[model samples]
Target: MAGRGDIGVRIGLSAVIFVLDGPGLSVLTTHAQEVAPGLPFGPFDPTRHRTFELALRAFVTAQTGFRLGFVEQLYTFGDAGRDTPRAAPAGDPARQVSVGYLALTRDALAPPSADARWRPVESFFPWEARRAGRLPLIDEFLAPRLRAWADAEPGERRRRRVEALFALEDDAGWNEAAVLDRYELLYEAGLVAEAARDRPEPPAADDAPLLGQPMESDHRRILATGLGRLRSKLRYRPVLFDLAPETFTLSQLQAAAEAVSGLRLHKQNFRRGVERTGLVAPLGRTTTGTGGRPAELFTARLGAPEDGHAPGLALPALR
Candidate 1:
């Protein structure tokens, strides 16, 4: 066993895989020792793999029986001491540095393993979802606690952050890309389960401060980073098509965008915006499977020059 004097770094890859699940978006999660499930992850073996992505794909398949497609490197999580529990053994003295990636799938396929399953993203980050309507949890549960925490001394700075990231007041609007920022703020305020675990003098878990679930080590943080990256990409790239069927109704397309953004869209406005982009074209067919009215089917112009040059889908959020 290495002593405390022995310092080392281990390279790990965490997969934040997202898939469209009906009207909601879900992430692929697996578990081992943590109270909550975490992203599919494994160590990067320099000797066994030629590239980091190959190693990530290999272990994810090994753990969940799922394969990865296009993935973007989201961030490098090298924060000292934040991942001590999962870095190695209890006192192995080696730090864990994870390279996180974001992946999107057309469907939420089953993982074929009990340990791995599709869990809705909103379940882990309840306050972020706004598709159904206003989240009562925000006003009734989270906001009150956050306000009290901010009201405590050093108030102004804290209060302003709370208002901005969460849109606590009408003057501010929630930034979908601030997912990790919000979580980190909650951590500092000792309002999250992770705070209790990480801070010696933090508000105890008994406080039960609207704990939005906790995953092992820094997995939840990595998940938030991926979510924020994807949400930001929506404004400039039509990458949502990667999570959509080859042919889909405009409504279905809009639903996919809404699921990822965690916001509702004005129906006609969204369709008009998508049509203007020229990223998708009518299939000359219809899908009555939509259950209500027969909706026109359209396929994405994936390789068209116009598509490659086009901007993202237009999302006019309903105020």
Candidate 2:
């Protein structure tokens, strides 16, 4: 292991926390006055902090005032020149290596700081969400542009990738877990701000499509990594309960799944899947505030599982 002095690499921690709200899955974000919103990010202090996760939890709480729960390390970002645009740490000129994390919560806390706020996840990746059905930006704009780029390429690999990731062909289906892949493709095509920032020259077209809102630094890329990890984890883990309330209705549970996956599920089918897994149990209570008949409330049975997997019916493949 390299000591702190061996390599001038400063470790940092960044988190992408998602909360379900009226609009759907929203992320906790922060920024200075008149600056682009970014994930809760801060440098990890080796002296005062014992572990990297502890240091991350402390800074995130101090900055956002939202306590993190069920945080898992997502990835480590260490590309040079990516952290240049942001405020550098005080010390020697060093490479900033950030350990990214993903956390989920049921409540959206008000940021005590004036600069912090909650922004909808779809705002950063407009093309990823499918709750609105067909997206004009994808069908009308992104498809044509990406198709053109794929055709210009010399090999079948690029075309195949575009088709699979973007769901360009009629048979090809969209994969929510491929969030990072999709983002990297957009960056390579010069559709995103990070691509332009990384390249020696600006994108060829002055009218290049600003794919989505950009973060201050490579925070957006880190966010994509978190998003992809969460989506993929839904398949094998019961981590989704971290985003659910202590007690919630079945419809509410379905809504949470839909919000995170960005897919509108068939109510009956979803309920059937949930039942088959025996993941939830009735609370012996019903609420009538749903604007219709009273619906039964259910709570996730965290202890019911014999093996380690919890039934997560959020993704389409689960159905």
Candidate 3:
């Protein structure tokens, strides 16, 4: 029996969580008044603003003093009571729904303004570690509980869920783009602290630290949405260019792909694939100072198709 006023208006606000490569996959984040001192909150106001996109542009510029580029919608989260309690204004019945977005930009830009940082994404979602080889944490911690859930069901449905989540059929493999699904599954099973509700006492600290560090609020979840989108979109779009340097060696490009995808890629095969996609062309430049070998420089092809007009370079299979 909700009235017209009871129903919250659909408000859109864009957020970008950039993945910066250094030692690992890092997320660029900002601290607003809620998370940091001496920060204004009015910049995020959706009302009296024409579009969330414009608001986002102003928000980032105000907070970090850097203009963002190559942006896209990440996800929309509208779960009731999801915002921090302390920040909710009195009599503000409207649910604070946030429309998350992701963007890829050059890392050469200066560090974001104070209270913002680029923290390793693994710091928040360690279960995403497919970098080394096998996911031992998954096999040890999540598998037991997941199997139990599957066991509760009777047949194909159970098998399908198990196979999809664990990537078990024929030893198939893990897919990194299922970030949101994986988090939701973990939440449903009470594997993450955020999933806990109506409990008299908080659950004990998880012994398995496979999942990354939890963010201040649902920022981590929003980040997962962005990561999933970027991982999938890069396969069919040339958006990877946004994150690349103006000129890069093939190895550098490969490394960027590997960092974003969270998987190892074959060197020769990856280069061949990139060349075949017509996404990059040689810049008639070569550098021999990369230590032991000479490397040719290349740049991403200009005027590449946007919104899936042209096929993107095929990424090497994840190992």
Among these predictions, the greatest lDDT belongs to: 1
Residues 1-319, candidate 3: write the lDDT tens digits: 7677575644435465565566366767666556422111223464566776677777677766667677776667777656442234556676766677787777744465875667667766777767676677777777887777677777877556667866755467778789888887776556675655423565455655434555544666777788888888878877778887788899888888877777777889999999888889898989885565889999988574565486665677656
* Candidate 1, superposed: residue stretches over 4 Å from native: 1-6, 33-35, 85-90, 204-209, 304-308
> What TM-score would every model get versus the actual structure?
0.93, 0.92, 0.84
List the pairs of residues colliding in candidate 3.
123-213, 124-212, 124-213, 125-212, 126-210, 126-211, 126-212, 127-210
The lDDT of each candidate is 0.84, 0.81, 0.68
Q: Looking at candidate 2, what is the lDDT of residue 97? A: 83
lDDT of 2 by residue, 1-319 (tens): 8676675777878889988878588889988777678888888777899998898888888887878887888889998776542445545578888889998887776778777799988889999888766567888888888888888889898788888898876666788889999999998888898788778997788465587888877888988998888878776677778888888888888888888887777888877878887878899999897778899989988785777656666454332
Candidate 1 residues 1-319, lDDT tens each?
9686787888888999999988888999998754567788888889999999899899888988898887889999999867553435666556788899999888577888778999999888887898876678888778888888889967499888888888888656668889999989988887777777787675844444446878888888999999999999888888998998888999889989999999988999998888888789898989899899899999998565643564787778875
lDDT of 3: 0.68
Candidate 2 achieves a global lDDT of 0.81
What is the TM-score of candidate 3?
0.84
Ranking by lDDT: 1, 2, 3
- Candidate 1 contains a number of clashing pairs equal to 0
For lDDT, candidate 2 versus 3, the one ahead is 2
Candidate 1, position 3, lDDT: 80
Give the Å error, residue 174, model 2.
1.1
